[model samples]
Target: MVEQGKEQETKDFHPAPVWLDESYLEPLLRDLKKDPGLRITELEIKPATAKGDNYASVMTRVKILFLRSSAKIPEIEYYIVKTTYENDPFASDIFSKYQVSTTEMLMYEKVLPQLSALIEETRQPEKVFAATLHVDYEHDAIIFEDLAVSKHVLADRLIGFDLEHTRLALRKLAKMHAAAAVLNERKPGILTKFDHGIFNRYTKGFAPFFENLCDVAADFAATCPELGDHYARKLRELRKRVMEYSARVYDPQPDEFNTLVHGDFWVNNVMMRYGERKEPLDMILIDFQFCSWSSPAVDLHYFFNTSVQKPIRYEHQEELVQYYHTVLVETLKDLKFGGYTPTLRQFVLQLERGGFFAVTVALTCQAILTNDQTADADFNALMKDDERGRNFRKVLYHNKTLQENLKYMLPRFDRSGLLDVID
Candidate 1:
């Protein structure tokens, strides 16, 4: 009886490898074979590099050797398979929202192909707007062409994107935005087909954390007695607007200049390929899980406030905006889009609209972004998330990187009148 029990226990044990489901993989093989007409005679799956946000990721590098009926040489291709945590429901929910994976699926399958055709029609250079190999929405999984094989590398977020990188990213951004404008113009009801926005609700229960963070900011202000009252009043007023401002961009505005935003357009999501002279030649945007239809400014402010470092932001803020406008106008003209492009003053107004949201992120997320997050580790190295809420306020109080960024940003906010939160 004892031996039988042991055997039964052993039989019940089954390991879960979410990235290696045979049923989900057949479609990928079929898609791949359509071009080369070859079979993946053998393949192996192993873990690949991954990072943390909320997704409980199981990333696998798939190596495949193709078998052809009559081939001169055998070829090996590579792919990366990514999926949510199969074992942890709570973790999966935290990382993803109601239909985040499905949003990404639609972007890859429907939207990107249309964008690619536009790119070809307009006689543009590259299709850096999209990069997706295969997707399985039901499984909350995607397979990507191994970027390393294509000699592309993820830009470093800690150091931040320089001027050239900014231009490159923004140019591609403008092209996609141009496409969105034309498409929306043709059918007024089209943009609404996309999801509301990405990570817009990640700021849930932001009050407790914002209140605690205000106390921390007040303590810092006390050190400079001259600025104490100014900051104290600012923080107090800001506490009221934390949740409101963070929740502002969810719905689309019919009257405004709404365009699709790669909602999480930041340094890390951009991949670059350097030329012979060691300069960035081309770039590709990845991770459309946060794609949304909103003011084009949402993406603009996101890139400016999160990715661009202090020097570039201080020196070239206006210049960069102008440069982006120039590219956007040119691309729109190329597409035979006759609609009115927003003027420089109008663009600045959009920046002001997104400023509060930008400030909130800078105050709450710098530490998380600056930390050395390895594959096994996450952004919450110094903080944690639980039922009560995220411990971001504690990080604001103690984290050096967060403190330094706030110091840099607060003065700029005051100068620009962005801290006039009461109005």
Candidate 2:
């Protein structure tokens, strides 16, 4: 969506609707209290996140000063309001095809509460998610308590996560998966509608986006002295099968461990709270718009390739996977899970089977996440095959850090047979 009332050169962002005001929020506020006399004294709205931090929704932070009773002091509340892009053809198409907004609303309205209750039932100390305040289905808006109030901050996407952050994230991820698996067993169809992940049979909206990014990767491979004709040709051919490759990798196999995965489990979606020593004390995952009922291995690959810092990204993967698998199995057993739990060998085998996913993320999502020139990047600039899109891709592919990451990763991917196209 293009920002209105600006020159062609200005960056685009989805603006909050004209209807968002004190009157529209009063009822939602009252729902939080039993006091019919609750009155909003003041309310302020501003852009919640910086450009390129999030893309699926327009994040607007609403700060409210309200009085629950005349006898009590007025209280302040901060909420991050998420709303969909309106009237834009691309937004309309993607939302309609995938029902992402609806799915996310369901997550907040139904799934997350149950997951939190499950953790509490087991008396586990793991922090699972932020508290959701409201879900406005009519307007496609979700109001969440701003985690910043609790001193939770997002790990640096450009710099990537260190071993501690990665370990904490994987541990929390395991708890979530374990709980969801048990929850699903109790309620068979709870996770049925969560199958529309980024790569699914329901839509091809990202096909062109991936194709163009792969092209950029191949072009970079050809230009870099270290990666000459051979890598370039491999990247080019791999570009053709991007969709099929991801589809196969995402497809769940029988007898393999599967549960609800945070499909976009990258740096942006993970928020961490640290201690005085800056050690990660807890991590909470956000953005359920891309959740899928698939092997947790896909999520593990996605997080490692796109979010972990390069120093440990490659060498320490086995350690991270083993730690996660151990936590997963322990949590499942603690929860009295009746289903088949995959052994470390089976889980590692599944991770290997889905190894191509890491390559896809490195070549596509990793480059986007690590690019610092994010102010001008948006859905239009990244998806459309126009001059603006091409220029944005140039900035993304040519990022110094991204180039270095590719240089270090391409050969490893080649060795893993991730670059080869299977007939």
Candidate 3:
């Protein structure tokens, strides 16, 4: 069910693009043969998400009522459309520089379909991806059937995912990682262009943004009575090494298992369908804008830190990792992949080697995901170097919930030496 709050917020969102009318969509529908000779009788468009829900792209929900070629009655269909940021130049530049738009287009147009075909060959009952309807590079838009049409809804990001959801997510993630490995094996060098994830040499543009966030996190840690100055000092020192550390953590290790990491895997990107008893029946992953070729550990750390509930995130991590490993290895074996699949111990070592990513995510994107609903999420507003940006940073980092989470997490990170520089 669409939350009442979300519905009202959607109504209040910015207007849709001027060109996204019936004339532009009708031809696209015809190409997909949604209905031969169908005519769009009515068209509607609305912002697909509220502010802060997404930043890299503008999502608009498009709905059309059409008359079928042979039937007299009209039928309604819905689509979720993704286009590049219209007016946000900073976001546009960053996305372009990172090839985010082209990469996602390729994922939908090429990679994901092949991955799904491979999964189907395995006869797995689970569906792991959303169906892409069209990719209009001319308009810079990728359209997909709104998963809401199939009773899928996003889990609440603020409350985080419980044990059931977390395990389900990890299982699916492992399958994806396994499938990715087999896909790459079958078609070598297919994923070379995806080497750049969120942090790479091209990340100089975001250095201020990340550095400021680190400082904000440090200040927040300093104020916590339990953490005091020690952890704060550690975080501040870590700030200086942000780029270096990100480079090391993001680099694929030669001896470890690597797959196409869903560079931004968290609650919001994974949609779920539920049964009558409210148990999750199935799930699908969305948002390939940041997909990268990296260690599965990167995806593991990013998801656990940002999406899983604190109890499970802090306590049952071992169980979750083992469960994911089991599914991953089984899937790889079932697919008859020729590459070496890491043993559980090797996987654990990979996770340990990639442990700094947990700190990286927790200190940066986790706070963004957990921030109060009212926080300004405009990419330029958050990235600017003025007083306004400083205040916005305060709003993002000083949230009570985020503060509480940091209090719980910081000590663990310190003990693991994640907040310290490794020589």
How high is each candidate's TM-score?
0.81, 0.95, 0.95
- As for model 3, its CA RMSD to the true structure in angstroms is 2.8
- Model 3's lDDT to the true fold? 0.83
**Model 3: CA > 4 A from native:** 1-14, 34-36
lDDT of model 2 at residue 121?
65
Tens digits of per-residue lDDT, candidate 2, 268-345, equal: 897888899988888888988888788887799899988888877868999889999998888888889998899999
lDDT of each: 0.65, 0.84, 0.83
Question: Among all windows of ten consecutive residues in candidate 3, which has the lowest summed lDDT?
Answer: 6-15
Q: What's model 3's lDDT at 23?
A: 89
Q: Please write out the lDDT profile of model 3 over residues 340-359, one tens digit for every residue.
A: 88889988988998888888
Model 2 lDDT at residue 184: 92
The TM-score between candidate 2 and the true structure equals: 0.95
* lDDT of residue 3 for candidate 1: 100
